[model samples]
Target: MTATATIDEVVCLRPATSTDFDLAGVINSLLKPVYELPGAELVHHLSGIGDVGRMIQDALDEAPDDLYATGVPSSGTDHAVWPVGGTTVEAGAGARLAVGITLPVDGSQDIFLWDQDASSDDLLGSVTISEAEQGQGSLSKLAHSDEEHSYYYVNYHVD
Candidate 1:
């Protein structure tokens, strides 16, 4: 019955429920890193950038390819950073945070949270959590943490 007034910053919710949405499977094994495909077939390799929410920070600190994520489009194996575009379901608040993202073609997801008040672009920290298949690492750290902000997801059919 109510909506945020401006696109200056917005949250967009995905389909609430999907016949295709397998919460159990996703929890078990849906979002797994993509390794089967040859690296050539890899559209891109996602890298989690830390504390890079500011556009000015991007200029001061070089991105992986030494290019800016805000400028230029994703091309070839550029390995550029892109914000994933979608809605993030926040716990407790029952309020969804609208998110924008550009990620790899596979299960590996680079997590980014935009902070409106702190930075101009409105982002805070960068944490990279790969497909759950990574087993244990930073991804596991966030997964196992008491709480987490957002995640990049993929949908696969078990049937």
Candidate 2:
């Protein structure tokens, strides 16, 4: 028997509220467009419209958080790591890791989500899947930090 697990995507429900700033003091917020237009153009068009322009500019200046994943097979001591997608995924966006692994029939594997940061990587959450869970189909686990939460979806099978 063989057991396999595939990570489909990581969905961000709500990002951490605390601003993650780089050395330049820029906030790393969500990268997804909130205003539907380019940030610079939006700021330019909204300028002289009072604090609304400044508010929009501030929101646009924020950058999305970078994320990645890791899978540790029960039979091995090393972890297989993969990037979620590009450099970052904004809140409310889903990033596809598409990482898969095969194991022995009786084996199990642990999957982890992490936020890559300039200082240090932060562990978002983790879940374990075993051969016993085969045929259960898709599984989702919600992992969270102090102020952020994300959903990790995986597909498991045994053959």
Candidate 3:
């Protein structure tokens, strides 16, 4: 009989820091004109520009690490069982995915985490789950890059 592995959620304990700041600064500058428009001040005040700006600046201070995951049911296979392309999750947030993927009882799956960016994608880390690990469980992995480190928690179950 075949068993199915279900992905419950992926939690980001910490996000990676960005080394590229010039590009982000340039992008923010391009949006300055929008803030200079007439009535923009009123809108800004109504929307709490101080708070919004702080949040935007905070995000720009780090890598726009929009996270996503991919699960390969088996090694040497070009097929992916979950997230064909990817399902993006917010930085330092958890994505609850009740995606179930079926595999042979003796089969195993490798799950990878990635940070999606405009320039290029960064691989965060990966974890392998075997059918023998059936039942609810969580796995943790740390992804390191130059001076940045990212921590992730993956929760899943096989039955």
Which candidate leads in TM-score? 3
lDDT, residue 148, model 1? 19
- Which regions of candidate 1 are displaced past 4 Å? 1-92, 97-108, 117-119, 131-159
In model 1, what lDDT does residue 121 have? 27
**C-alpha local distance difference test of each model:** 0.24, 0.45, 0.51
lDDT of model 2, residue 155: 36
Provide the global lDDT of candidate 1 against the true structure. Answer: 0.24
Candidate 1 residues 61-101, lDDT tens each?
31211111221222211332333232223211111223233
42-159, model 2: which lDDT tens digit per residue?
A: 3334433564423433453433445555664221112325542334333322323344545454577677666656666556566676777777766555555533323333333444
What is the lDDT, from 0 to 100, of the residue 22 in candidate 2? 47
Q: In candidate 2, list every pair of residues with a backbone clash.
A: 29-63
Q: What ordering of candidates by lDDT runs from best to worst? A: 3, 2, 1
What overall lDDT, based on C-alpha atoms, would model 2 receive against the true structure?
Answer: 0.45
Candidate 2 lDDT for residue 52: 44
